[model samples]
Target: MTEFIPPGTCFLDLPSPFPMKRGGALHGARVAYETWGVLNASRDNAILIVTGLSPDAHAASNAGNREPGWWEPMLGPGKPIDSDRWFVICVNSLGSCKGSTGPASINPQTGHLYRLDFPDLSVEDGADAAAHVVRELGIERLACIIGNSMGGMTALAFLLRHPGLARSHINISGAARALPFSIAIRSLQREAIRLDPNWNHGQYDDERYPESGMRMARKLGVITYRSALEWDGRFGRVRLDSDRAEDDPFGLEFEVESYLEGHARRFVRRYDPNCYLYLSRSMDWFDVGEYCADRAGNPGDTDTRAGLAAIHVEKALAIGVQTDILFPLQQQEEIADGLRAGGAQSEFLPLPSPQGHDAFLVDIARFGPAVAGFLERL
Candidate 1:
């Protein structure tokens, strides 16, 4: 009989040492995940949700809790995901600071926190870890694999690495590879953390964390995650306090500046700096074409189409936001085009939203229909 895991957060311990894409292996690695709905006897009505850079396993509320999730707007009994019909599983990324094994987790080898010592992680590693969870649940094939941002990259890696694992794929604001501009922005985020005095080369004491650097890094990230169009429309030279003097230089003069600071402060309290470094670097190194090349005769070639051509899913949907400067629409177009070239039924939907890359999270009205229609067709 299949072990019944209730609808809530749970941990899946890897039975043996987990191998990474780079050299070395992780011992006692565990993945934190959450499930919603019920799996039928066949265990085929399953959808795996891969999160972006910072989400935990809690994708949506369940019987145990009622709090809205990060993507709560699009996940519910009657939402786009419709938890009542499909068994949904969301896994926290491998190198995240959540309940999953990460830089903050204790290293079995030395009985100390891994910190920067955690083995380098890749998008493929995240996919492999999630795949293990699927097998542990006795699921042979997934109804669909859904991903956004970094999660989208993980979905691609899963499709390329473990062929026929999923019947369909839904990629939202994801890319085949990290672009140079995104890499450059993330590099600055990492630098901010490293430059902080409290960082101490990633060896700071528990009480003395690198809050300033992490805060600044998150501030920079917020800027890139949205577009200037959004800022102009939402905050548009609006002062935080009308009574404040226009010449006040020491305090936050604009509403946008305060907004960024608030988000950064909240992020620093929840995320570990080293884990951020590892996850960000992992995204920078990801290339679906590289994974595709491994199956081809010449592994060194940079043929993106050849890599995309390897995906054998029954259907695929790639959604892009017009103002998402981070991932951009061009990358989504390429993904759709490549999948079609590979003989898979593919559709590309471009959405116009001032929210930019984060439209999938907040602009549910536009994203929900597109996602729901695709899943319905599958």
Candidate 2:
């Protein structure tokens, strides 16, 4: 029912009737973005960042927004991303509720909310919109394009669909395709929202919003975002104080339970339910292997090798956490091997972090250095 647009964000008007990867098109649609540092005289020091499912374009505070951002620690002057040396640009995904055209946005022709009526969204569509933003800024080629989580898939799509767009890449906890387990998890999350009475087939207003469904969906995501090792070491059956305990038998009793409740509450209203369903299914439907030229021959078999080899880049780095379950370490390895097979000197680094899929966000010590080292060499 609400769209969260960060302060000091900039907008780029996409071409009229912007085509979607699946079907349909968007007219007078715009993408939200923010920038740091100055583009060098050569205009070649640009690095574009495509974010995960939920983050806004405000990756780190810029001149217009002084408040801290989601990746504040890793992106700033003298930080791993190092705004001092690079002209950094971060764009929110096209189909996200965060300041981007999505199910939460208005349809120009109908003068009403797009909601489920919005055209089918795909990760490749996000990639295409981001490419349009890049070209609009007069940049011919990017120095590097960084993608995290779902963004990693978008980055790969950007590279393949639009060859020679960037010279390097950094993929953190990203995958070439959605795994069955991940897809199942997202499927359950979507089901939770759909089953909620307040969801009303994506017709609910703020007063009757699907709070319970969103809470459950977010709780499921938080569970998978971190590893069991971290959960055990952090909350390990710790009981809440009697005063903090709930009267209901199934109410929050453990620190982990309280944490999930608080986390879900904070996120429920900030994102649109319909947007969540659209984006979640987008990831499930994404299969980079489908881009391989021999698709007709392969039939149901999916192999990403040929598709990965089709992308061109001078160098690449695929980072993964050993504890990651959603994307897993094998996906990072697959990306690295794929890039290397394409003749880009690529490397895969798997960190032994207990933070799981969210290691890139919290375990900055490892991810930060790896990212900085790769850029330094570039």
Q: State the lDDT of candidate 1 residue by residue for 1-378, as single tens digits.
A: 011122456899975689999977899999989888889888888999999999888778877656767788788798899888899999988988787888888899999889889998898899999999988988899999999999989999998888888999999999999899999999999999999999988897658889899999999999989999988989999887656665875767789989999999888868888889999999999887777677666677767777787788889999999999999999999888888887779999999988999999999999999999998887
Q: Looking at candidate 1, what is the lDDT of residue 142? A: 98
TM-score of 1: 0.95
lDDT of each: 0.88, 0.92
Span of 10 residues, lowest total lDDT, candidate 1: 1-10
Q: After superposition, how far is residue 362 of candidate 2 from its true place, in Å?
A: 0.9
Q: Write the per-residue lDDT of candidate 2 for residues 58-97, one digit (tens) a residue.
A: 9998898999999999999999999999999999999899
| Clash counts for all predictions | 0, 0
Worst 10-residue stretch by lDDT in candidate 2? 293-302
TM-score of 2: 0.97
For candidate 2, give the lDDT of residue 161. 89
Error of 2 at 321 (Å): 0.5
